[model samples]
Target: MGSQSSSFSLRIWRAARDMVVAWGRIGYLGAVVGVLLLSPSTYRGHALRPILRRMYRDTAPILLGFTLLAALICLVITRIVVVTALSYGLSRYALEMVIRVLVLELIPLTAALFVAMRCTIPNATELALMRQSGEWAAREQRGEALIRAEVLPRVVAGLYASVTLAALSCVVALVTAYLGVYGFTWAGLPGYTRMFGQVFNPSVTLLFVLKTWLFGLAVAIIPVSTGLYARPTHHDIRPGGELSGLARMFAVLLLIELTSLMGNYY
Candidate 1:
């Protein structure tokens, strides 16, 4: 029994140590990418092309479909909120609730997850495979800054995708909410604008923007970092690397969401 207890404690210690190490690596990679992103030299000539191509690849293909999906979701949820508020004699607060819930929260989170599934996860898996096959090391040995050439572009693309989708979806949600609440008319524009302004006061607007950027950063950084640092395994790389990256990204996203909630509400 004592031996078993000691073994279990050892396992727990190793797990905790590994978690800390993983997060440390992620932080270090993020800082490096952030510096690269800010450095003008990294954007010169050849590098700029890849970043632009990645941004277009990540954003263009799915924009219309994502916006339409967001609008449909916003419409359904707006109707539900409007109906519920009417039933409860709280119609005045319905628009604010819709804006708070859909625009500020749901749309951004949904956009991040969508981009992760569509682009980043697959990118990460490819990077992990490259890492495992020694391609990254070979490039490094050849005096190439693989982080700038390879990682930075993907990170930029992820950030662009998340922010673009969220911004567009928020617009769609607002329009849907207005139409749902006030029908197809212009009479409610002034009142709707007033409430929109109230819910998105300066502080809340800052928080919302910050939250969305953090979401983008998580969507950008976690998977790529995971892939860049993943260890080789005998089994297929996809399941392990992609699953771990997704889990880490989700955790960071959840933390950002919770912090935003606290800032906005408390």
Candidate 2:
């Protein structure tokens, strides 16, 4: 019993240590972003263009599919909100309810998670392979151009995909909400705009912007940082390292979502 208890305590300590290391790597996003800002000069060399193009190709389909899914979800939720509000004789609040629920909260988070699943995991794997193969070391020896020509493109591409998906999904949800509430007409535009104004007051608007930006940053940042933590000489790269990074990334995402909810509702 004492040995079992000691083993359990050791496990807890290791888990805590890993969590601290993951949080420390979150600072890497700042450095990556700073490098990304200076990366445009590398565009003149044309080396980064293919990478950007490939990232776009990979991301566009995912964005389109996820946008369609978000639209379907928005339609279903809008219908339910409209029906429930009408059943309660509170039909007047249906649009506001959809805007607050779908637009402000769900869409951005959904987009972030979609992009993280689609983009971040593969990018993490690629980075891990590069690190393990000594390619990252070779690049470091070459110069900062490796970051500009290689790493920053992937980082920026992920950020772009996250932001684009969220913005598009939010627009789709708004349109679906409008059509669900009052089909095939602009007559309700005035009231809808008024409700939008009221629900998205300055504070709420700021929060939405901040939350979406954080979502994009999280999707772009976490996996790559964790993947880069791989030991260059480590051979067994299968189960433990990859899963640990993904788990930590999603945990950070959940934390961001909870923080947003608390800030807005609590």
For lDDT, the strongest prediction is 1
Model 2 earns a TM-score of: 0.85
Clashing pairs in 2: none
What TM-score do all the candidates reach, one by one?
0.96, 0.85
Residue-level lDDT of model 2, residues 186-237, one tens digit each, is 9999999889899888888888888888888777777767665765555566
lDDT tens readout by residue for model 1, 1-266? 99999999999999889788878988998999888878998778887998899899989999999999999999999999989999999998888999999998899999999998888877888888888888888988999988888888899999999999999999899999999988999999999998888899999999999998999999888888888888888777773256656778889999999999999999
Backbone collision count in every prediction?
0, 0
Task: At residue 144, give the lDDT of candidate 2.
Answer: 47
> In candidate 1, residue 159 scores what lDDT?
92
Clashing pairs in 1: none
Candidate lDDT (C-alpha), each: 0.89, 0.79
